[model samples]
Target: MTDISTTSRRNFMKLAATAGGGLVLAFSWTNTLASAVMEVLDDTNLASGKIDFNSYLSISPDDVITIFSPNPELGQNIKTSFPMIVAEELDADWTKVKVVQAPLDTNKFERQVTGGSGAVPHSWERLRKAGATARQMLLEAAAKRWKVSADTLTTENGVVVHKASGRKLTYGELATEASKVPVPTDVKLKDTKDFKLIGKAIRNVDNYEMITGKPLYGLDVYRDGMLYAVIQRPKAFGMKLKSVDAAAAKAIPGVVDVVTFKNNVAVVGTSTWQVNKARKALKIDYEAEAPLESSSDHDRIFKELLSSKEATVRRKDGDVEAAFKKAAKVVTAEYQCPFLSHSPMEPMNFFADVRPDGVELIGPIQTPERARADVAKLLNIAPEKVTLELTRLGGGFGRRLYGDYVLEAAELSSIVKKPIKLVWTREDDMTGGTYRPAVRYRFEAALDAKGNMIGYKLRGAGINSGNPTREDNFPSGAVENLLIDSIEHQSPITTGAWRAPITNFLAFAEQAFLDEVAQAAKKDPVQFRLELLDKAKNAPVGAIKYDIDRMKGVINLAAEKAGWGKKEGVSQGFSVYFSHRSYVAQVADVVMKEGKPAVDRIHAAVDCGIVVNLSGAYQQVRGGVIDGLGHAIYSNLTFKDGAAEQSNFNNYRLIRMKEVPEVDVYFVNNGIDPTGLGEPALPPTGGAVANAIYKATGKRLRNQPFINQPELKTV
Candidate 1:
């Protein structure tokens, strides 16, 4: 995974040079590296010298190695893991390495986005080269000073060694001289087996700061002369502002002003409490802009769309209708999932200082570039006139991808002619925020007389769930005849990407339906899936999008680890899925407890290629499983007249900590490029838990929020 490119090497090195005493090295994802670098030096030294390197790695005279993590960190541990990659290749002392969040610089960093679990996979190679390049430059510096060939020099824990002469120099001792060496494009990357910091378990760099209640998240951002604002939007999706009465709100002692923007009213004041109180005092009127649809309306629409002849054919192989007509048995089922709120711990908040010259924004946003561009567009300014800084996110879950709140802060600042910090109440986020679209899927399978599946067909309907079908996934290539199509109903309800997007609920529905088909065919659930995977591997029907070997690796590992079908009194349910370029298989162990099925443990097998941080990977898998299981069991979002039915945690049930089951995670480290861990583990969890429930009870749960099922009961 090493490459040598002389793209902009000399120019980049020239930009990296400093008048004072620190060595800096950087790498750009773009050709001709030209922007940000990680910097480490004394406060005085940093102030005295030019501090710029296209943002990646810098070594100080004190041997402090600072690695800049270019991606937004939202508890996915990119902050810790990204630095680990660079430090591993740089051969720096892990203890002396400091991780920093790099500001958004399109010129310096590429793909600064944090969504879709793509940050690590995209930055893997470039980060390794950045570190290796720095290490090479330091080695060459020591070689010149020693009058020996650079080939004889080796780096170990921030020190260069010439084992033949038994002479060594710390990276700190050669920091100044290293800066003068030509940036090496012919740098070598370490083999996975030689990694010292990557595979090892490492704690989050901000663990102490987070636990001690330090200021890290966007809500903690503050600036001089800042005004707090709380926006009041229409309660229903298809409603617009009619009239606003801000007389009572303006009479409040702390209320500075109340202004209307884009059909929403913003109450500005000096403190959060003041603005919140003033906002509550105001009386506003709203008018229906469109039909105020409800959950029942969506249900009817889903039915109509599923049966509609007008559908977009995403993929088709062979003749599905012909295969179905000749089949001996056909099994059909429908699965439904409700809309969900992102519900990140920290509510939406952003600080914006909009001036005539430029705008400064600070927040916990997943997409900084979009936010900057959006603000610039809104204010009629150039994109370069906006400076955006990223803070540690409390939790993203894909909600931060949209820059609506960022736009709100910038717009309010411009209106009030003061620095504005806009904060959304939990109610605002839950009822008015973009949500995970409610989707319905109808799956049909045709089996021949030999109990072998011949045809697979799927039709999906959703409220803004774009392309609800994963047309190229698992079962598609395994069947001789396959057809996947989807239709969506346009609605005023705003919907956006959740954790795993369409697969979050699709996996559950598909796997559960497959299990039912296996029962109809009188085959074991695990064995049935294995047979299909074997078909895809040996004689695929169409273009296979998934790696058969990787998928089977996880399935076999999970089954063996959970001792599938071996534990008496425990109903084990198995499920596997491929998403975000990774494969995950989970087996849930359910046992009867007080006349109710309780999942006691789950065994997970993952093939995400080379793991960056073992501890973080485990944590991510465990967290994703818990999130998926909890949401499947109890979480749901319903609507009445285009208004959310649930407001907060009291009504919307989250899995209790005590109710969480034990999770055993195992990874298949096959030495491939690392994929994403943030989302792949979550997609299959619902399926495993649902299948386990079905095994425990003779009833099938086709709907999400299993608590809604009348036959299901829990303590």
Candidate 2:
């Protein structure tokens, strides 16, 4: 299957060259024309003859060069950052570079994903090579023309120059000659210090398209004869459709067809509004499952798991029992976090045109490769028969990872035998979401007389919706000398990734508890953490997943910037966490406003390896602060009778413009490779806010949605 996708992409690249140069010059690190060309050349079985450079680069006689990218852009600023890599090495004008989404062809494109905040870091090395390879090829061609050594020809801004000969040629003029040269396997990439565009503050290429409301998103995609669709999923988790009276739905104006599938009903119409109207008009009967009995039942299951004697210990260090026995002061606390919704601005939607021969799918999807395979499996068609088109996502936040909505659209289109667009209304999207699993964490810390940490034991239990396997790649205990155990409290509700900081959510509770331990010892919070990190770094407890030095770097930077121990009137709190391969620490300053905890300012420091686009990196950190603020102080998803209690914004509140506080971000100046910013900033925010709340009220708020305490007065 993988081989077939690779072949298809190579064929597409060949077709792209012969099809009147309809190539879209998009720069990408993951998937691009250069990557496709390289794949065919590298494959021993696939390369039949000398690899042609013309397959990857298309230069018009008019001096225009177009590069094709296979990866989709979903507002994480890859459109700009990825191109910077290409332009930097190709010596092309940044202003002249244009980006377009690459079509799905497994054979030609590499890494057709836009998640895990890995776009820049993963593509950095490869993209530089692609650009340099192309540049070198063009230089070789120019050197031949000028009758000079290749070393004498230096490429500058896509122009090859021979200083002694005073000869120059644009890459476009030498493109044909370069096409015959074999790709160099050992091309040198530019050093970080020599980079002109990589570290610079460049705006997102799609910023104008987004701000002006251009048709860049999947919702904006239109076809000549496309029909709109709305599905009626089960009202509650684990419910099954017993019957659906679609007679009235079909009677609605512009309603084309009504169909029933596995667990939902679909209403197809001429317009989205008409389909929505028809969907609502239809009456659905669902067989309520046992999980829908009550929300308390689910809570009880989680509690039972937490208390269960049997568990898999993720990490265990040095006779915790003996250490606890010798401790002077023992601290134990339990923290609980509720289920969360991804709630992307753009609700899930997909457009699919399924025919007997093939299927054409278009929409906002995060995992294009996964979507292609899933659609093919559902349609029972060869993977090649399925083509997934990616449009700019309004907001992904991991919701688009699950291509169920895409499969639904394909199924509807196949049944109707026409092109159909399936749109989930706000209600449907909210209720039918894959929620962040609710979790309960239990922590026990044994401290010596001087408030020195002796032993730490942590246990976590949650509805395994987000992660079912106790030993998944992530969330598994990467900490040492710690007993990290997880138990699944199975629930019928769907679950998926909600940014980063999944297990780190427990870190907020753990780090806050550490602060409490410090207080019990009359020690400073920052000092305590640094001491613990020192211990974790050298004599480490169980596993050594976190780079203690990197964590300390961020922590110390944030502490120094926030004046960790000097502030008098204002109270200070701090939290440091490492996740998604990025390390972040935040120091929050809180002051009581109208007798409630009001954050005045938050100082953050991050070490996310390398800074790809400084502006985009800063935006992610800033946005993460806001996102964390909302989750800590306000966000919660409550359920009653297995149905979400909060339907929309009115019931489920989000941090508004007025609620945003001043956030100052400081990036550690280590030019390490870049890590994720999208989620690393999130985990620390919740803990920082919790720590701030403690400073204001002198009370530890272990539970999330901290504002809901009845004893606390509202502003």
Candidate lDDT values, in order: 0.87, 0.74
How many angstroms is residue 573 displaced in model 1 relative to the true structure, after the best TM-score fit? 0.5
TM-score, every prediction: 0.95, 0.91
Give candidate 2's whole-model lDDT.
0.74
lDDT of 1 by residue, 1-715 (tens): 1211112323333333334476866556553232223343333534454544446577777788876666889999889988888889989999988877777778767778899888788878877877888888899899999999999988899899999999999988898888778776467789888998888999999999889887778888877678999999999999999998899999998899999999899999989999999999989999999999999998899989999999999999999999999999999999999999999999999989899989888888999999999999999999998888888898989999999999999999999999998999999999998899999999999999989999999998889998998999998899999999999999999999999998999999999999999988899998999999999888888799998889989999999999999999999888999999999999999999888899999999999999999999999999999999999988999899989999998897889999999999999979999998999999899889889988999778899899898758532
Give the alpha carbon lDDT tens digit for every residue of 453-554 in model 2.
777777778786434222322112222334566677667887778777374466577678778777887888888788777776656545566677888899
RMSD of 1: 5.1
RMSD of each candidate relative to the true structure: 5.1, 4.7
